[model samples]
Target: MKILVPVKRVVDYNVKIRVKADGSGVETANVKMSMNPFDEIAVEEAVRLKEAGKATEIIAVSVGPAQAQETLRTALAMGADRAILVQTDAETQPLAVAKVLKALVEKEGPTLVVLGKQAIDDDCNQTGQMLAALLGWGQGTFASKIVAGEGSIAVTREIDGGLETVDLKLPAIVTADLRLNEPRYASLPNIMKAKKKPLETVTPDSLGVDVASRLTTLKVVEPAKRKAGVKVADVAALVDKLKSEARVI
Candidate 1:
């Protein structure tokens, strides 16, 4: 089985985020960067499949600027066999990204595509489904469990009610959810080893996919700051405050 994992380069979750001075986007200058957390889960799942002998080759792909190579290298350190960089200068919408991945799937002819359920920055949660539609393949989104089979794959997904299982034919797409697995950090040795991993760079035109974005950002703004509240001295005071000052009742 060959699994293609699509990843993203985003602001490190641990770092404090700052809005750009011009309000066009987030400030990224001198900012620490890392792989998307959800993508990390997807990568971990793909690596586990390889470790379990269920997957043969794991190809990690990232679509973004040249800096995205760093994110792809992180996937290699985590055990991806190869990397593909779909070079782009600005952030591409989910639809455009799906188009790029669809082209890749055709070129690589992989048995499966794994992706994060949603990106941290955009939170669009549309690429995997869009790619599946574009390729006319089945999709299992928010997958928490995966069972590789001879001719198909069983995926346990998280639904609003609980968990649901679906069997997808080979050459399907799967998106990772939070409960999939805890990702392991790359060791220094692995990081050094990843330097030798092959990363093939490609352009959207190379695949003959139109890169027009389906959506456009009309405006960007910071979230309103949460207001601080005062604490009451006693349980009786709390009840009084809730009824009067907080006006709950």
Candidate 2:
């Protein structure tokens, strides 16, 4: 089985986000960027599957600017056989990304496509489901555990109430959740080897898919600062504050 893993580049979680002066978007210039944490987990899972002899090849793909190749390289270093970068400067919304992945799925004919449940930059968790819909394939989203069997894969997903398991046929989509697994850091040797691995670049136009942005960002603003806590004389004061000031009761 060949597993296709889609990774994304985003601002490192440790970095503080700054909105652009014009409110166009978050500031990316002179900022640290790295692979999406969730995607890292997806890549690790794919590598584990391959190591277990369940998968033959693991292809890591990214849909973003040219710099996204770094993200794919990280996947390669983690154990992806090869990497593909869908080079595009335009902002790729979830739908556009799904369309691109769908095209690749048809072309590559991978047995499974694994993706992160959401990108921290946008927090939009729609790509995997959209790709499954486009491909008319079974989907197991927010998967915490995955077990591969002959011609089928069972996924244990996290739900509001608890966990739900579903068996999906081959050629399906699975989105990795936070608790799925811990990702490993690439060793120095693997990082060096990743530089020599095949990294293919393609454009959305070549795939004959339109990647125009559908949503408009009206403005971007920082969250309001929290007020410092105040001390109260007694329970009566706390009740009064909750009833009148906070208006909770």
- Compared with the true structure, all predictions reach lDDT values of 0.92, 0.96
**Residue 234 local lDDT, model 2:** 100
The clash numbers for all candidates, in the given order, read 0, 0
Give one digit per residue, the lDDT tens place, for model 1 in 1-249.
899999999999899899887788888899999999999999999999999999999999998999999999999999999999999775688888998898888889899999999998888899999999999999999999999998799999999999999999988999999999999999999999999999999988888866766566676788999999887799999999889887987
State candidate 2's TM-score.
Answer: 0.97
**What lDDT score goes with residue 154 in model 1?**
98
lDDT of 2 at 113: 96
Q: Write the per-residue lDDT of candidate 2 for residues 90-197, one digit (tens) a residue.
A: 988999999999999888989999999999999999999999999999999999999999999999999999999999999899999999999999999999999999
